[model samples]
Target: MLKNVSNQQIINVFKFLEAAWSTTQIRSISYEEKQKKQRTHAQKMIDMFDLPTKKKKFETRKPFDYSGDFGELEPLKDDETMFVYRGLEDKFKEFPQNYSKVTSLEYADGQEKMAHRIWTMQEKFLNICKYGERSEMIIAQKTIQIRNLKEHCQKNKKDTLARVILLEQIQGRKKELKKLRKRDYKRFIWLLKELDLLYRPHPLYVDLNTRRARMRQYLREETCRIIREKINAVYTRLDSEKENFYTEKEKVLSEIRKDLSDHNISAYDVLQNVRKLRQERVVERQNKAPPTPNTYRWIQSDKDRKKAERRERDLHRNALVKKGMQKLAQSEEAS
Candidate 1:
């Protein structure tokens, strides 16, 4: 039963037991001895709790001596300097917590402000020492980074980020291809063939070559055509309705113009008269129109009538089939 129990559950049980034991009185022991036993028990509980250990502090390395051996190496060119600085910025952006450690580093320049920047450059150089140039690990790391960047670009709809990611992916694929070519030419050729076939049909079309597949494809095309035709028909109907509405509106406007013209009124007076007449006609129509019913009783009744008709048709068909079977049986018996 304990095997299935979690460490936390066990710890909790132990805590409850400790609490229960503390509440009980022990008359035989002195106060000091009882206190010492309690302290020992607490220490044991602490050990059993399995609390997190403190992390080891990062040790600062001694500053490099530029005077004796190298006498200060040549300063980086503008482009190189910018590249280095950019790389440092990227590293800090990736791991902001590491920035504090870099700032704490002792430097002779009295510019504690620049220590983080210097630390970034030093860390990059150290990484190069630990992991040689063009290491497989570095390539794998870059591939992972590019993949993440691609996902980020896709989510955020960043065109520039997408382009950069695409470029990186292409370059990474080229490197992999180059390596494959050097290691195994056959595999390299196979990969090239695979890439070529990415958008094109496979050489062996076993599944798609069948008559059924052809028929299915034809059916799919026919279905799409039918749907397109239906959509076009609907659009045509809508267009005709719109044209009819416009024509009717034009006719009404013409009648209004003729009516106004008969009065020999000014254009402004005619417009005002048209508006009044239109409003009066609208009010008259509203008054003449029947009031809407509270419920859709007519629609419900129509549906019930259709259902009854369908049921009658089914009953008639079933009766005719049964009569025909009985007649066939009688003919068989007479024969």
Candidate 2:
């Protein structure tokens, strides 16, 4: 089935799958983080919504015992913290729309697991939506690609900096994500309004016990439609991603070749030259400049002038030379 698929369709399906997966994964996998945050505020929200009021406010003793100091400071209590959690839950009524997948789960290093969980949800979502091959990863799997490039560079005697350029490209994408946030929030807000109209009246949304602002907008039908469209747009990028990989690979390879030329290193001599260049810079930094002559006008004819200039340059060059290389050459006339 994978073989018969046209390249264009493949790109389309991949993008289709990515968008499908990103949204689905983001929505489904996020519950864990939401649950954790809500667990902290469960008492307050239950009280606010006039739901069953069994849960108690988590209480605590004052950290600092004070009479007059700190202007009669109030004790730091768990109810305040609980209310903050309630506030967040209230503010993010459309929690499923705005939050990315629960990046990190409950523990400190659960971020990777959360990402994987998101991907898994996306996979299942694609299966439901009929997007692409069930096995296709939404985010391109780049570890093998990155490692292979590194190994190739090491074997070919290429510069390490040239080999790592693609890795830098991945890290630099955060700026692109920050740019996305600006536009994404507006879209998110629009989605929230839609949800308010449609889902807010649904039993699950209102009874969430947290009063999300969007639930008041009465726009659930529009919210779902807009999100569906956004998912389509994200899916379209899969083809672009493949093309991006091709371009980035070409760029890195071209740069490696240019690095050799830039340093005048033969492939066989690259390592040897790298060592020599560092030694040269160290010596150059240590050495003092030779004093210049008052002028190279000795007996002022072009040939004598040329010879004088060459002699001066060679003397200075030899003074600056490290143990390995030849001095700057003297005048052609001297030869």
TM, every model: 0.20, 0.15
lDDT against the true structure, per candidate, is: 0.58, 0.50
Q: Which ten residues in a row have the lowest lDDT in candidate 1?
A: 64-73
Best by TM-score: 1
* lDDT digits (tens) for residues 1-335 of candidate 1: 77899999999999999998988857587899999999887667546653333547998753221101112212323222232244465456566754534433332232332333344444554564444433333333343344444445556764775666657664665566567567767754654453231112225645656545655666678789999999999999999899889999999989878876898766797679899999999999988969777698988999999999999999999999999999999999999
Give me the runs in candidate 2 sitting further than 4 Å from their true place. 1-218, 258-335
Off by over 4 Å in 1: 1-217, 233-248, 260-335
Report the CA-based lDDT of candidate 2 relative to the real structure: 0.50
Candidate 2 lDDT over residue span 1-335, tens digit each? 77987899988988999998888784444878888888869667655554544457888844221110122112222222122133365455566732412322332232343344345446555664446432222222222233334445556655667456645633433233334335565533442342221111114444444346433333565578789999888888876698889999999989999998998878778778889999999999889687787685555678887999999999887777843243324444357
Model 2 lDDT at residue 166? 45
Model 1 TM-score?
A: 0.20
Instruction: Give me candidate 2's TM-score against the actual structure.
Output: 0.15
